[model samples]
Target chain A: MAEKIKPPRIRVSRRIKKNKVFKVKVKFDHPSFTGLAMADDTTEPVFNRAKPVTFIRNMLVYYGDELVSRLSLSSGIADDPLFTFKLKATKEAPVKIVFIDNFGKRWEASKEIKFKG
Target chain B: MVGGLTIPLLSVIPSSNDAHGAVFQTPKDLENLTELERIHLPKISLPPVVEDGASASIVCSVDHPMDEDHYIKSIQIMNFADPIVIKGKFFLTPVNGEAYLSTQIRLSGGEGTVWVIAECNKHGKWAASKKVTVAAGGC
Candidate 1:
């Protein structure tokens, strides 16, 4: 029997205040595909490099329908990719974040925050 | 007789000797005026001076109140002392008489800090309110 595969996950957080700066962090978990190569009777490695495993993570901030900020994470292991960013929000808006891995896989998540008076 | 003698005494005042010396030949021409009256001439109102490493703010007000949809199209903050860019943004909104714009800035690659400058656009002109500086903590 073949083992099941799991998709990546994303997390987001922000302060609940109006017109205040807040920080956001994103993370991704790498999927294990080593067993699949063994079952196929192939010694070829799945990853191009000899590294154990790796994952790619990205962070973005959106205001009202516009992409206000973006940051890219490169050459990091799959343990967990974390990033921190600052933004000032004047109104209550939803922040969307997207994360993608090297295997052409993608995951997305979002968080909505309200500014306090 | 005192008034007649006063005129002769006033005539002894020295005047500028120029080609058109007759233009200012009387004692009245050499009379020293009050300092305030002499200095009160046409002048341009200059903005307040903000020192380096110091903070300042700018404010923009409109004749009429605007709704939440109103936003700042663009903004640019420049350091008058040098050719450094303090902050640049495309969208911002004002609330409670202020719009908070913060920048994660570093001076000559020293330590990273946050420089907060307030700004607003009224009618068609832009103005700044004040500046607030926040030192960098950790990553």
Candidate 2:
């Protein structure tokens, strides 16, 4: 349970394409929370991470209103992760990429993709 | 017994940063690594000399098919000088038709080697590294 949601830096290599399988890289910054242990009656640490952990949970990508892909992530992912892939599109639309942290906080960013059909 | 000893050996890992060590970010972890001969390491693009503290985009690319059954699982960037070696990691699926990822990373002063490793979902792991010289002062 996160009380606050932090915005992340997102970048899309290009905003326009030729309606074919176009390659674009999606980059975002995320922190992984690591809980610390304390001795005493308390079993849980005061705050989960002595330092912010770079673990992220899931990434939901949307092409306009339609979902394009969903990626499940783990602490195995490094901090400030970058994902690159080719997009197959037929027309112009807005590409929305949402990063969901392990705490369930959601931050979203978007890019306008113009595919020359 | 081999079975009983193996369990303890696996748990007796070094007191390292297991919290965020992703995978092959250190030499100890690379001991018995799979030498993915067929998988080619990505082509890394960066300036010959990066100013210290200045943000520089480290682009890595590879020519691989991004099919549903066969695809690049993830990519990792590591630097030995960095306190935390893992600079970054990129995860991908078949939806993304190619294997490429670029991101900005700040380097400390002096010379260091940047290693790039990619893992294909079906295949093992492939790696490549580049020697970078960070200028004395960050611009």
Candidate 3:
């Protein structure tokens, strides 16, 4: 019989963009294991232990091969973490975001928009 | 011989006395009464408050004609958005007849002003000094 390996989960979503400001949120729920332990005389207790987890969130903006801006956020939580900042982008350039989680997990995403003529 | 000596003595001395009596004009006898009066008068001038990226200097003068030593009380720097950045206390040194201070500040923000307050420590009493303001730059 083969054992199953559990993978860490991360959810990244775009929140809002208005007046040249961009905001994004990232969230993660750490994996945990439950075990039984003997305590006192005849009583047993259930112990829940969490695995080690660390994550870093970063947003990178590029114009051609040149990197223009970068913002990074790191946290440990079950809910989403958001970051908001302003960027001056024209129709010719696009912005990219990269989120790296613990256990060597990596996620890459990009967004492109045309300027109003 | 006796007659000539007595005549010479009488001629040298005034008989009843002149119109004005003997006037003493010695350097040691002269007293600084007017100068003493000026020393007790209070004369305190406040310094201008300096904003961030600006330079400010303050000069305080005292009329100590007798060169008496005194202390300054409650020197404060106010109107600072963040007081942690500007360093130093309010006490000053007695130099010449005055105390001079030159403080240069580099603030974090580009706007807002500050006021520098000073007071004289007269024993347990305090004499208030003038307030100076440093204006901020326009955005």
Candidate 4:
């Protein structure tokens, strides 16, 4: 069974204008473990094999049905990683973000891109 | 006697400082790299100048296919003068918007060259460097 994953949170700027660039921020509540660090219980820094390496393997951003951006991630990203990027909002549509962890858990969220008239 | 001798010693040491203005600089002799390796080199974008304490938005990408068998493994952002040169590393895949990343980095040194190095799983490392300076503190 896939691990329990939290829903991804997406935020689009409110003061966006048509044909203008706007910011989109997405945050995921997940642990990105490299599984190379020592366990907290260990006295010395040693590779901990008890836990498996897991991270957000893939992140996709979509404007309505069209794929606008995609980010393939690794354990290099920290836990609860927050990413910010820009998109030119040409129309009012839902900006969706989907994240798939290395363990195959899928999480997603969306926010409407309402441009300022 | 001491002052005169020191002057000659200083002059004998080559000035390693860059004389050119703020600009992104990369190795000129890229012909040595295989055509495929040259294609994997990172293309970095950033402002030439920024406020002393402001963050500089950086975008790096490579014009290469991210195939499963041969893809860009990671993009590393490094500061030439930072005690810890490696700022961050982003691993990518075919789904990663054409192996692109947009983020901001503070040139804590106030003025210096920042580098973005991209590594392909099969092609090794390709790097690009950009120089940024604080307002009024031109490099």
Candidate 5:
């Protein structure tokens, strides 16, 4: 089933030095469930067993056209996880992140790189 | 006759490296991890104590060069007690200013240790761990 997914919140450090590394922070709204939590013990079949696993499986980070980082995630991550990583902006470009979930859903967000003097 | 088969056989054989082009690898066993050089070890920073079942902030980084030829490949957070030992793994590139990551992880009930493993393309793997005490009840 298709569902609406809000774009991820992305924030890039302002006033970055030329050719210097800067920080990028991203937050996603996701359950990130490990599928280990049981919905109910009294039910004939546990509620969790019937439900499919839902979590972000892969993440890719890009600075402009160049691929910067890739991540393989698991259920160990908490709900609505926040991630912070470093990136060096050689040229002015958008820093984009794409996340793929177990259900084959893709969500992405980007922010323009603003350089400082 | 033998020469005719040679061409087909050579093409059928797959290359040793991955065809899909995976730049980094996850060490599954201790032997594979031991084979890597112990340089550029990761430094882990987190509170020494926390409330039970509370989310703890974790910051890890490696002081290494991010050159095209050599750089930190990935950073992994692990806990032996968790259902999945690897909490998360982040693969990196030269564009990343440095090998640094800041995130949060929830520790299981009770006190235990958490480990951070860093992998470098040229240098093998380096690891560091910290003990976190989870207070049973604070409310």
Candidate 6:
């Protein structure tokens, strides 16, 4: 990214609760520019085949080794996208979230937490 | 005139609604199969009214067993008004652990309908829809 942003932060609430549905919160600092506009318009040198892949198009969230949820996004999504979801609190598990932009670049993060029974 | 029998020209041409390659635009009168209805369910989740040129969300969640044995096969979305149907597909397995899906879509101004169909890997298919109204001169 041209502009540096803070790293993404993730938290799972009621981390130690058993049999309770887990709530996940994720936030990242970044500009999600859209590639659609730049895909067609190339008037300026800055956009010279810049390959407008500015916005994220796919997101995958996994609990443990299993894929639990995924989001298929587009330019319509806001910048620094925030997402929340629920997974039946199984035993202590590891979580991984991955984001992919239109240009085929991928960003991913993983977290490990403990659950109390 | 292969055997002196005149072949009707109309019979040789495929009907406009029966275009084979079209994934959308299913004809309402075809009687051979319910394949179209199978792909696009009978009912779906949609907002009663949506503003013009606004982003709309279509929910394809159906209450089904999400255990290792039973789960939704996949979710398919389509809109009859737009040319590109078969918008996207979300494949599901027990690993997903959730029985729901939501897809964000944009309408091309005015009234439009979006369809959702969820196929159960073990059970069958389910369908739903949403009706939208856009503001004047909006999409």
The number of the candidate with the highest lDDT is 5
Please tell me how candidate 6 rates in CAPRI terms: incorrect
Relative to the real complex, the DockQ score for model 6 comes to: 0.06
TM-score of each: 0.34, 0.56, 0.27, 0.51, 0.75, 0.59
lDDT of 1 at A22: 59
Give lDDT tens digits, candidate 6, residues B1-139.
0012121222211122432443433435434525544333323455545453334544555555567787666766665654233445556566555555443444544566666656776546554555556453111
lDDT winner between 1 and 4, please give it: 4
Per DockQ, what order, best first? 5, 2, 4, 6, 1, 3
Predicted complexes: DockQ each: 0.02, 0.10, 0.01, 0.07, 0.30, 0.06
Per-candidate RMSD, Å: 25.5, 13.1, 35.0, 14.3, 15.0, 14.7
Error of 1 at A51 (Å): 5.1
After superposing candidate 6, which stretches have Cα over 4 Å from the reference?
A1-20, A23-55, A69-85, A110-117, B1-45, B52-54, B80-88, B136-139
Docking class for model 4 is: incorrect
Q: Tell me each candidate's i-RMS in Å.
A: 22.8, 13.5, 33.4, 14.3, 14.2, 16.4
lDDT of 2 by residue, B1-139 (tens): 0011110111111223222334443323433423443334455676667664335457676667777788787777777664345655666666555666545564555777767777777765666667778775221
Which 10 consecutive residues of model 2 chain B have the lowest summed lDDT? B1-10
Instruction: Tell me how candidate 2 scores on lDDT.
Output: 0.56
Backbone clashes per model, in order? Answer: 15, 11, 0, 0, 0, 9
The lowest-lDDT stretch of 10 consecutive residues in candidate 3 chain B is B1-10
Which residue pairs does candidate 4 place in steric collision? Answer: none
lDDT of model 3 at position B105: 28
Relative to the unseen true structure, what is the C-alpha lDDT of residue A46 in candidate 4, on a scale of 0 to 100?
A: 29
For residue A88, give model 5's deviation from the true position in Å.
Answer: 0.8
Q: Return whichever of 3 and 4 wins on DockQ.
A: 4
What class would a CAPRI assessor give candidate 2's docking? incorrect
**Candidate number with the higher lDDT (5 or 6):** 5
Q: Per-residue lDDT tens digits of candidate 6, residues A1-117?
A: 633555456666654576555556566544564332223334442222333545566777777887866666655443554554445666567888887767676677777867765
**Which prediction has more favorable TM-score, 2 or 6?**
6
Q: What is the DockQ score, from 0 to 1, of model 3?
A: 0.01
Candidate 5, residue B21: lDDT: 26
Error (Å) of candidate 1 at residue A95 is 0.6
